[model samples]
Structure formats: structure tokens, C-alpha cells
Target: MPALDLPFSLLDRSRTRAGEPDAVAVRATVERAHRAEGLGYSRFWVAEHHAVPGIASGSPAVLAAAVAARTHRIRVGSGGVMLPNHVPLVVAEQFAVLESLYPGRIDLGLGRSLGFSAPVREALRTARTDPEKFLRDVAEVRAYLQGRGPVTARPAVAQAPPMFVLASGAGLTLAARAGLPVVVGGPVLRGPAPLAPYRAAFDDGPAAPAHPYVIVSANVMVAATRGAAEELLLPDAWAMAASRATGAYPPLEEAAAVRRRSLTPKQRESVEQFYDQAIYGSPDEVVAELADLVRRTGADEVMLTTSTYDRDELARADAAIARLFTA
Candidate 1:
């Protein structure tokens, strides 16, 4: 397959597998980052998911520090740290410390998502999802990171790490007004219509880039055959379906195990819907589809968040996908 013209990255949520400790999943994420650096991926991002059973990464800043320590060249950051669950000053300080340690290799991707469930939200001290509050928090975090906030964030560095907004509807407007780049996926990637306004409305202020930038996030998998690639996606798809049906996201099971279990009509439909949104195929097919996606969306980068029960298979898929971006 021909190399993709633009950069590509990986976003690992430190997905846990059945019968494994959460520590193992965290370690796997670090190891994957080390491999990602060697494979020539532009960046390796971790995610934040509070009180989620399937995802072991509750703190992206902590995970990003671990990843940065292990990897030499790959950019390390959050795919995002949800702003609603954090204090702006504290969030800025945490990422400032990371940037101080990692220097030019750190990134801070911010999002507006709250915790997964009501209990989780309460545990996070996040009562409601406020878009305006999120916008203010994002700005405050950026200000602190840039040394422009009222009080200085300690261990301050000469430069702030680049921030990307994980955006959607109001998020696009917020990012545009803030003049920050955006990372969008799901329905936003279905067509170019959603992004056109964002591009048109971009501020491009002194704190922002000269132009609008977009990073497209997607669940991508690759293998020797289309069937094998599709199989790798089943674990996550099944977990998502179960989560939708039962409200508890369980650790990923082996694809074979997932296939053997029977599902209710709603659960089955959920699984199929998950599959419909993901891109899984042989290398050539994935390259073509991703190329088409990039062409349509005008994405500056593609962030893959593919997860499977088998660590070995996931590593191989990562290497194969990396080859499509590297020479």
C-alpha cells in the first residue's frame, strides 16, 4: 500500500482484557507507546475515562508522563482529558509539568465530556455538562499554560505545549473562537459540512495557529485479510454493545468468546452499529478508505483508537497501520 501523505497517530485508552489486572493494561499502553515510537507514528495519545471498567486510564496526564518517559521521539498527549471533571488551574499545572519534563514532545488535547454515568459524574464532582463552563475552563487552562493567567502556574516552561480541542457541535465554535485546532470524529466525520463553518469562523489569533487544523479520530484496524481485521474489532464492539445494554463496560473478551455468546436484539443492533462506524480491513483496503476519509474531511492527521482482546494482534495491527504512514 502507498504511504498516506499526512501524519497518523494512535490513541490507546489502556483497554483491560478479561482475567488481567488493570496494571497490566497500563503497562501494555506504555509498551505500545515505545513500539509506536519505533514504528514512526507521529504521536501516541492516551485517553481519560473515569470509573469505566473496560478502560484503565483514568488520568491521561499520569499515563502521558509514563509514555513520554519510555518513548524517545513520539509526541505524547491525551486524546483527551475531559475538562468538566478537572479544575482549570490544576489541569494546566499538570500538563505544564509534563511539558516541562518532555519539552517539545508534549501535547494537551482537551474535551468537554463528563464521566460515563451519573455515579461516576458525582464521584468526579461534576454535576452537569455545561458547554459554556467547558469553554471558559479550556481558555483558563490555556492561559495558565501560556503564563497569562492571574497566578503563575509553577515549574513554568518557556513555551506551552500545543492544545487541541476534541470538538463536536458547540465545541467546533468554541475551538474556532479560541483559535485552537480540533480533533473530531463520529458524526462530525460523516461529511465536510460540519467543519466548513469551523474553518470559516477560525480566529487565528496570536495564541492560535495561522489556519484551522483538524485531526480525525477513528477506530481503525488492519490485518492480513479483511476477515482477520474485522475479527479484531469484535472485542471492542461487543463490549460497547454490552455497555449499552447493561450500563457497565466490561473488560474485553477474546473475539472467539464474543462470537460464541448470544445477544439480545438491541445489543446485536448496537454491535452492528459500532462495526458500521469503524474501518477494518486488509492493509490496502484500509489505506484506500482512510485516504478517502482524509480527502473528504481535509484532515491534518488521523488518530486511530483501535482496541482488541489480543495484545499481540493489536501490536501487529499497529505496526501494519504505521507502515501505511511511514516510508
Candidate 2:
């Protein structure tokens, strides 16, 4: 593959592995961030997930602070903070503090994901989320960060931190209108058609650059061989299938154990679909796929979310991917 032009970032969800405690998983995430910084990754972002046994990252802002404290250069941020889960001002304050501590090295990526489950939704004291409300909430959060409203976010600094919107196609348009950079992924990003509208409608704002900036996210895994990478990816695929089969998301299982079990037709289908969406293989192959993806979408940056059950393998994969873009 040709040398990559776009910068690379990592999105670590701190996926909990079988028999591994949440604290261990979170510690591993921070360690991974440190490694990514050493490997020359441009940024390291964490995700927010609640009440899911498989994901240890519950509060992105808190985790962001942790990672930021450990690393000096790489930018740290949320792959997203689900805006509907908390008040807009509180979110702003959390990120405001992050920026104050890190200074010019923090990002605030916001999304409109509803709670992972109905019970989780109730636990958060949030009702069923409305799409319209999510847009309004984004505006409110941005307002607080910019100190545009009468209210001042505590510990205010000279400027608000940069923000990236994680949204669907419609949400992309909203981000464009809001004049913020956007992080978009999935099938829509595989082709040029969907992102055209986002590129056309984007308006330069004070927070982000005048030109539109888009970060494309994907599930990527790289290893010495194609089969080896696929084997590493199987645990997460099976876990996703199990989540669909039994409404209970479990921790990542060992690759051997997951491969030994028999999956129902539906479970098999889910696993296959999840596997198909990801980019996995040798470094050359993975880089080639990412290059094509960037070419199709005109992405300014690529954010890779690599989740595997083995911490050692996960770190190795991170290194291999880093070599692809950073070499």
C-alpha cells in the first residue's frame, strides 16, 4: 500500500475480557495509550459504556483525564460521551477541566447514543431518547463549552477545547451546521455517496478549522498473517453474537473457547456480519484497505478501534497498525 497521508488515532473501548476484572481492563487501556504515544499515534480516545460486562469504560471524561495525565503529547478524548446521559453543563465542565489540565491536547467527541439497555437507561435516570432532543443537547453542550450562554462553565480557560461529533448521516449534517469536525463510520463511510452531503454542507466555525475535517473510524486488526488476525478478531465477534442472542453482553471470551462452541444460525450470521465490517490482515493488507477507505471518503484522519481478548495480542496489534500509518 502507498504510504498513508492521513494521520491515525486509536479508539480504545477498554473491552473487559473473561475472568479479567474491570480495573485490570481499564489499567490496560491506559497502558495501551502510553504505548500508542510511543508508537507515534496522533491521538488516543476512550469510549463510554455502562452496565455492560464486556466493556469497562463507563465514564469517558474520567478515563480521558487518566490517560491525559499519563501521556504528554498525544491528544486524549472520548470516542464519545453519550450526550443524553448527563446534563450539558456537566459534560462541558468535565472536558473543560480536561483541557485546563492538558492544555491544547484534549478533544470532546459527543454522540447521541441512547443507553445500552432499558434498565441501564432507567439507572441513568434518562427516558427513551429522542433524536430531536439529541440535536438540542449537542447545541447546549457546545454553548456551555464556548461560554456562549450566560452561564459559565467552572474553571473556564481562554478557549474551549476542540470537539468532534460522532453521528449518523443526519447527525453529520447537524455537526456541519454547528461548524464542528465529525467522526463517522460504518457502511456509509465505505463509499463516497453518503459523505458527499456532509462535505458540501460543512461550515467552518471558530472551534474547528474553516475547512471541513472528518475522521473515519473502523474496527481494524493487523498481525503476521491473515488467519492470525482473524483468530484474534473472533472473540469479539462471538461476544457480539452472544449479546444479540441473550440480551446480556458478556466479557470477551478466549479465542479457543469461542471457536469451540457451536453457534446457532442467527448467531453465526451476526458473527459473520460483524467480521465482514472490519479490516483485518497483514500490515500491507490492512493499510491498503484503509487507504482505499480514506480515498473514498476523503477522511482527514483514521480512528481504529481494536478489541481483542488477549492483552498481549491487543498490544501487538496496536503496534502493527501503528507501523502501517507511522512507518
- lDDT of each residue in 1-327, candidate 2, tens digit only: 556866899999888888867899899889999999999899899998888888889999999999998899999999899988888889989999998899999998988887667898899888776677777777787788777855998778777888888977688888887777889887753545377788788877555468778898899999988899999999989988999966657899999999899889999999988878889999889888888888888888999988898888888898888778744
- Write down the TM-score for model 1: 0.97
The TM-scores of all predictions, comma-separated, are 0.97, 0.95
The number of clashing residue pairs in each candidate reads: 0, 0
Q: List the residue pairs that clash in candidate 1.
A: none
Find the candidate with the highest lDDT and give its number: 1
Candidate 1 contains a number of clashing pairs equal to 0
Relative to the true structure, candidate 2 reaches a TM of 0.95
lDDT of 2: 0.85
lDDT by residue (1-327, candidate 1, tens digit) is 688988999999999999999999999999999998998899999999988889899999999999999998999999898988888999999989998898999999999888878898889998887778877888899889889999999878799999999988878998998899999888754555388889999998787889999999999999888888888899999999999866768999998999899888998999888877888898899999899889888889999998999999999999988888854
